[model samples]
Target: MIRDIDVVVIGGGQAGLAAGYHLRRRGLDFVVLDAQASPGGAWQQAWDSLNLFSPAAYSSLPGRVMPGQPGETYPDARHVVDYLTDYEQRYDLPVVRPVRVEAVHPDGDRLRVGTDTGIWRARAVISATGTWWRPFLPAVPGRTAFGGAQLHTVGYRRPADLAGQKVVVVGGGNSGAQIAADLVHATDLTWVTQRPTRFLADSVDGRALFDHATARRRALDEGSADTGGVASLGDIVVVPPVREARDAGLLKAQPMFRRLTATGVEWADGTRAEADTIIWCTGFRPALSHLAPLGLRGPRGHIPTAGTQALEEPRLHLLGYGDWTGPASATLIGVGRPARDAATAIVELLSLP
Candidate 1:
């Protein structure tokens, strides 16, 4: 039998749980469907050394505050995983795991969420599946011909995995910088960036970044001047470990190489660097393959969204992908506002008082 729910949240991560929290408050019948066998979502997959840019308190969801880790300023990935596992239990959110959604299809007024287990017909579907599964690698020439070990952020676990080998780290985002820093002392490292790396001020953390995003969102909503938001501050935030690497002059990034060689990489100026491994800290694209049945994805592979809802399909809300859905919506702290907004909108749509 097809289970019927008022809403079906397509993930059980921070964004999905946040949505569940608000929906419960609104007295809605919903279930968060997760593909993973357990809780913590993508945090369960993060590298061991990864930590949030913000302190624990600043990185929180809707109802509860993430407890501060006494000795640590920024919590590591395992800490995050623990908090998430606890949060799931604390909220008592209805989350069904190991149910991989195969597709979302239109079934009259309700949407049919086809999964490996069975079908769930939901009035509104919130796609909160964050971008961990879909690691992106740029199409540099001869990349396929490279003879060394190559991996993306999703494939990375620990620096010791590549111990004693010459490693090249690609991408200049926080992941790139953080991973590079983690590997610096562990391996022979070459950091490459498409352009000059942009590092935020030493003091800029998650709290400050969220504040900037909120301000920018507010200004845009008011149709006011452009505030630039968090993007204006630069890309990489110098987390503690990253700061240590920078202070030691180990975080320097060379110009992006032109292409991969059989053994390593070649630069535009004819310089070549031989490396045994290339770790692409390149980010992720949204995991929206289940929604493809709806034919809602645009040319850019993103569903056209207006304030979190698919412009073409109002019954669908794409949450926590990025700023396109909501300002800083992909973040733990930034996701609350958009989650609340989506829930509030759903309440109004169902004619709830």
Candidate 2:
């Protein structure tokens, strides 16, 4: 059976929910198709200890503020899950769950969204799948030959899982830092980075990064000199756990290894370290396989988009991927503006002719 709608939102994560709110407010006939079975999208998949860079109040959706936790300064993953579940019910957004969209292609003037269950023919398609599904592992020689267990950050649940084992944590992003801090006391930890990890000023957090992003966007709009946003600040934020770990000299990092050996990894100078496990925090690419039918993606995995709207296919808008999609569009708070703009654009597009 084919259901006709004004818009089809892919991925019911933070970005999709935000877009759904705006679309509902705009009176658009739309439905959100989520691959996941339940609410809280990627937050449910995050590490148990993971918390927002900012406080709950600053890390909220479009309509409701994420109420602060009873004793925690920054809410954990579970709190975020509860908040998203609540927000979905609060707004009464139309969401169809456990629906995995297979492909999206143009069907005459509209888009035909093919999924596991059925087809949704829509005037517009919003791809907000986000990056959680596509965890990236950097290309390295002998990676396949490594004897020890290797897992991405997605597979890591807790430090105790690797307690007393020689584990190497790789990548220089916030995930790398956090996971290393998590494993320091529990495991025999070795932190490796592509480069020396740079921590944002102790005071800087999501709020500060959002400010940079906003300022950078305004500069571009006004045709002024480019002001680098979050990218300019550096790699990781000094969250409480990270700060405490670093102050105790537990979060120190080493340069990345040249290649992986069967037993361990080797540096260019032939320094080798044996490891029982390697946890990669290398980051993720956009989850955009379903868009391959559109034949619009550039060399980079990202579809070239102008403020969430795909340049190649105007009817297709890509949200919550990263800064390329919109300034700070991937963050919980940052996604709201792009979501609103995407919803408004679709409404205008649908209303024409």
Candidate 3:
């Protein structure tokens, strides 16, 4: 049987929960479709010791605030997950948990969402599946034939797994730094980097970097896109790579990997770095393989949703997009606004003839 809903949200993370809650307030008939067992996407996948740097005040959804520690610096990963779960139950959002969506395509005036559970028809769709849906690994020689324990940063949860082992982390991003910092005291670790990273400082005293980035995004939006161009787009918070690795005495300031070896990684200047494990912190890809037929992705598989007031798909809107800035371009704190706007847009589409 084809069940019909006014809107079908494909994700159940903070973004999706926020969108779903708002959609209900807008009086639109909607159902949330989530692949996970419950809400909280990245929070569930992040390291055990991880916490949001943006404090509790800015992390709230449309109408709710994080339950505790509103004046605190940030909440840990587990707290975030707990909050999302509460948000769903509080709003009575119709979330179909653990329903894997196989494909979604446009049907005459609505979108046909096919899942293992059943087929759902929605007049509009809010794609809050986040930009970090897929983990991106670099293609390095001998990567497959490596004789060591290799894992993506996503799979890493605690330093206990890496304790007492010589671990070499690939990529100089924030994730890599955090993992290395966590494991340094318990294990022998080395961090690898080929590209220079921009290091944005952690919030000073109680001030958050998120506030700084928000202002920067607004300033960048002032210029005309006709002359400014999307190429000029950059992140609101650019954290330099050098500062993050500064504390890793042996691990700090290492040159980028030239190639991967059976035993370890090799630097560009012919230096060989040996380790027992390799953790790739390369970053993530957008979750849109099911929507490949839409042909909406831009360079390097990124969904280009900036500058445009709304997405090209009248029924579909991309969230957590844009390399530079928007309502919610690339951070957890930035996700709410886009979720609100997208939900409103979706509700409007559903109400129309």
- Tens-digit lDDT track of model 1 for 40-100: 9999988889989998889999878999887898998888889999988998999999889
lDDT, model 1, position 329: 98
Question: Candidate 2 overall Cα lDDT vs. reference?
Answer: 0.93
**TM-score-sorted candidate list, best first:** 2, 1, 3
TM-score of 1: 0.98
Comparing 1 and 3 by lDDT, which wins? 1
* Global lDDT of each candidate: 0.92, 0.93, 0.69
Tens-digit lDDT string for candidate 3 (137-190)? 889887987789888888888878878988888776667766766777778778
Residue 111's lDDT in candidate 2: 96
Badly placed stretches (over 4 Å) of model 3 are 69-72, 202-208, 224-251, 304-311, 322-325
lDDT string for model 2 (1-353, tens) is 99998999999999999999999999989999999999989999998899889999899899899999999988899999999999999999888999999999889999999999999999999999999999999899999999999999999999878888999999889999999998899988889999888999999989989989988998998999887767779999988889999999988999999999998899999999999999999999999999999999897777888888999899999999988888899999999999999998898888788
Candidate 1: which stretches are off by over 4 Å?
none
- lDDT of model number 3: 0.69
Model 1: which ten-residue window has the lowest total lDDT?
A: 344-353
Poorly placed runs, candidate 2 (over 4 Å) = none
Q: What are the models' TM-scores?
A: 0.98, 0.99, 0.86
Q: What is the lDDT of residue 27 in candidate 2?
A: 90
